[model samples]
Target: MTTISDTVALLSFLIAHPGITVAEAARATHRSPRTLVEELNGLLMCGVPPYSPSDYIGLTPLRAGDDSPIELHYASHFSRPLNFTPPEALAIKYALEHFSHGVDRETLAQISGLSAALESSLGGKAGAALRSAGRGFVLPARTERMRAMIGKLMQASEDRRVVEIEYYSSHRRRLDKRRVGVFEIIEHGAHFYVYAWCELANATRHFRLERIRSARVLDERFDRTPPERRDAGRMAPLFGGKAKERMLVRLDEHAAPDVVDDWRGVEGVKIKELPGGRAKMDMPLFNPFWALGFVMSLGEHAELLKPTSLRKELQGLLKDAIAAHA
Candidate 1:
């Protein structure tokens, strides 16, 4: 999905410059040149002209004249509103009312356009109940402190500034203060992570937002690396560089789909059907830890078919488990 900021940035760029090249747009937007080219090619998606190398930027009217300011008309089907619909707007207001702290009455009125009487009628207890229910029902609590921190981090990221943070790592059971160059915030499974280049570790790492004890924007800045290089370096180790070996497993028919879906992208997976309603799958092995655990999870339904060492390791683990349990 194109984020709201991306769309706004693109619109602002067009508004600023009457004529601009793809390269120029990319530089202005802090987006990759290739991505800007792709966006230009798909101008028709937004009901704009089939943008050419020589075409002027901005929303110019669909006419032959070159003197007029661009009066761009987006098709109704293509254009989405910057403002929320009634239900969405109401939901946002209710959420903010229920969960936000450090938000005063005037600010709430400004945000929700709700009367002071109505806001007060909701009361502190009602708001607390709403918040508790929202959390119970998987609705996120939009805390003011979290929003403020995220806003600061986003501004820092756009400005290419380093952030100093006191972070707590659950895995290592340690709290450390360090400076990190923030790149992107990624949402996964109902939580957010700040994926960044950790200067202290001299590598790319993901820091969970909730786990960050405290953060402060540092005056020091660093050059942002290209996104592709960051992605490659961060993802390559999952498959163990270039020297990893491929492993194959045989599964019963009932378990095949689950296994395939679970391990879809670690490496290329090949699934084959056996004559007796069983399935065989091939996948790359980064290390024996993951493969052994995966096969053991299937109980008796899965068997390691290749790489004799892996099968032997699994045999030992299974025997140990059985002995312990017995």
Candidate 2:
């Protein structure tokens, strides 16, 4: 099935090469002629919000057959693309730079080249932001194994195959084998997760790529459709299932800025400032392991105040950690 990204890319190509034949367009897009024609027909129904007929992409073929040349009548409307504001440019530039950290050298060079092209072409406050020397975010470099695993899983997902994965379940603190009907891979915070139907859990689950010890795609096929896209404003990226519990935490002055910045646009995240630069953060707890790691990362600056059971568990973890050090 053609995704929105695929359709948009095809539209962009059509806009660039008007009156292109179906055969040539199919070759250029790496799609079969029949698939290209179907996608073009689907585009006939696509448009921005408040979608009047004029707002829809207009396509007209020169003849009645699939082999005929096609024309995009309203191509002029999309000829002028939107410009990035300064902040938008800076955000993208910074993200690109940070993304360069874990990629192969050839990919890194391409990213740098793209950054330079954007910097030189933009020319203004936006351009300056792209040209800025400092990358605003930092992340540890990823191993080649992690990169390969992600790629393999992505291909498996596209092929609608069942994959056998040896995954490390944090809650179980052990590696276990699972048969998964892979859907889509998504990046949330610093990690990549495969959203899939898990036979082991008998439900849909997100498997963190880094924690997957190994994976092998099975010859068996899956009939499951990909999940519908969640609304970004209401959902947390890392948590796919409905949250069954809530937790409250108190943050010291030093941690408040980072917490507020990270959770700013996410719905159901409430942060209220207390006196002396401190704050209270109340959020849904999807996974105890994730919550534990998050609070532990904050160290002394953050305190988990609610859910006495979890607090005791945190205390036990601290004790174990201290014992290991001793």
Candidate 3:
């Protein structure tokens, strides 16, 4: 069955390609010929407000041996691409800059040209905002090994294959192996993550690409499951799990600026005034493992104040880190 999103995309495609043949339209949409006809016919009922022939969208269906091609009409509003808002323009610019790392010269030039065009369209405040947007989510330098592993996983995702990977679990502070069914790759906060179904966990899980020690695409094919049903796409980079527990920490003046910016407007997150030059923060601990690492990153300037278990866990992590360095 064709989804609403698919139907909308199909209409847009047809509008963009006037007089497109049935088979060609189906091929472009990755839908069967019959299904494409059904969707196109169904779309004919949708219109702006009134249920009349003039208001409703119409389609000319192509039959076998018909010289005239199928044409979808009555949507001049969607004939052109949508323009981006200021925030949207800024986000697109940032994403283009971030993903330009491994792109070829021609693609890079095209991106630059698109950016210039966007800036020109979104003049005044929008253009100034785009120029002043802080550098966010900088992609880290990738080794040849990481790039090769990423390439293999991309193919595995496309082929719907299973892969065996030796991964470094930061939460566990150890290396483990698992067989994962490729779902899709998502980039966020300057890092690449794979949302996959783990046979071991028997659930959809997100794995950071850089954390994989070794990867081998297996000859096994997996039963495909959509990421939406599992909520895998909603997983945050650092945190996963129930996310019911909260962590409290105190940061000195030196570190408060960055910490506050990082946690601004977060639900259940608040900061309290402190003596001298310090503040206390209370926020949800979606993943204590990730929480511990973030706290440790603040060095001596920050201290975990509440939730004794997290403090103890950080203590143990620190002891192990010291011993490892020793």
| Range of the 10 consecutive residues with the lowest summed lDDT in candidate 1 | 61-70
Candidate 2 yields a Cα-based lDDT of 0.78
CA-lDDT, candidates in order? 0.63, 0.78, 0.75
List ranges where model 1 is wrong by over 4 Å: 1-179, 187-194, 200-220, 227-230, 237-243, 261-267, 286-292, 306-326
- TM-score list, all predictions: 0.45, 0.62, 0.62
lDDT of 1 by residue, 1-326 (tens): 56654464456556556466555656777877666555544453443356543343334333222333434334333243343333433465566554343243445456555534334445454443433443222355556666666667777888989999888864455889978988877655456677888888888877778778888998898686846754524334452344257789999977877776776564466677777677888866644665788889898889899899889978998999999999
Query: Which residue pairs overlap in candidate 2's backbone?
Result: none
- The true-versus-predicted C-alpha distance at residue 215 of model 1, in Å, is 7.0
- Which stretches of candidate 2 lie above 4 Å from their native place? 1-12, 15-140, 229-242
Cα lDDT of model 2 by residue, 56-171, tens digit = 77787433256767878554545544456688788888789777654555666789889878888997777777777576887777887776777688778889899999999887
Model 1 scores a TM of 0.45
Q: What's the number of clashes in each of the models?
A: 2, 0, 0
Full-model lDDT, candidate 3: 0.75
